[model samples]
Target: MATDDGMRLAYYIVLLVVIGGAMLFELSGRGGKALRQLVLWVVIFAGAAFAAELWMNDGLGGRQTITSEGRIEIPASRDGHFHLTARLNGTDVRFIVDTGASSIALGPADARRIGIDPDDLAYVGSAMTANGQVQTAPVTIDELAIGDIVDRNVRAWVIDGELDGSLLGMSYLRTFARVSFENDLLVLER
Candidate 1:
């Protein structure tokens, strides 16, 4: 129920209308300055859209909180520990607070990600497992994260050597007091 100025209406229906409008305005100008500006704006907008998408999906964006410049403060977790997103050796991971473990246990794959050579750390010590006594190896993790919380120079132990990965044992959990688990989140109140 409308009249047109001979411009294609299909473009208007699907948001290509902006491009058409830009072109029309550009053509109307003898100097073509408007067209150049429109094109520049379109390019800039597209780039910004891509960048925003990447930032939102990336690891850095997931945990970063605007507490201050380059610092993310925990908003006082439930227990003594602050619950936040955690990554093991750059790999996305989920962990629960377990004070029972004497040292950090790495899933077979997690151990490899931390660059723990299976041969270097042998099963010198024994730790109790749900099933029974299990062999273990000594290793260290390059980094550990709980949400935006960062803990470095952490000690970890290798497990399931042939299988790969470890458990987030006391070695890493002891840093905080009384870890809390609620729903699908963990909070370290320290």
Candidate 2:
């Protein structure tokens, strides 16, 4: 094993030994109670670790599903926001569906990923965001696709300020024949 892996294993082993020794000392006379407490602690730690793993893997966002009839269903994330992954210029980009946003907004990182250079764009437009007015650069997305649906020459803006992630706003949602939220799920029909 690599040095780092070996060291980590050693650290975990040491931790287990220390914790086990302490538990044994504290529960020297109570056999049944000690076993029950140990089981409870194990369950608690296991549950916490599982939750951390799920959060790190974005499992909490739930999964986006596409139907055979070309309908897209997005489940609300734990934070109560609908998020979906779409192809922007053939590059996978994660976006949060924001009804308040007037147009599709791309963060600088996502803009660059889709072959748009933020440095080359002219920040002539301004947007009123929650953080106040921010400079924006208008651009045309060569292609934007969600599941089997695709659109070309899509108008979007690159926000010249801090953005957690890209925003999929009304600009694209308007194309859907039907957009509705039911039971914490956002459904988009073409």
Pairs clashing within candidate 2: none
Q: Report the lDDT tens digits of candidate 1 across residue range 101-170.
A: 6777766665655566665666886667766776777666677765456778777667643432344566
Off by over 4 Å in 2: 1-49, 57-61
Every candidate's CA RMSD:
13.9, 8.0
lDDT of 1: 0.54
Give me the candidate number with maximum lDDT.
2
TM-score of 1: 0.47
What does candidate 2's lDDT look like per residue over 15-88, in tens digits?
Answer: 56656765665557555776757755765575576567568545643678888788999988878899898999
Report lDDT (Cα) of residue 121, candidate 1. 69
As a whole number from 0 to 100, the lDDT of residue 94 in candidate 2 is 93
Candidate number of the best TM-score: 2
lDDT of 2 at 59: 69
* Candidate 1 residue spans exceeding 4 A from truth: 1-85, 160-165, 181-186
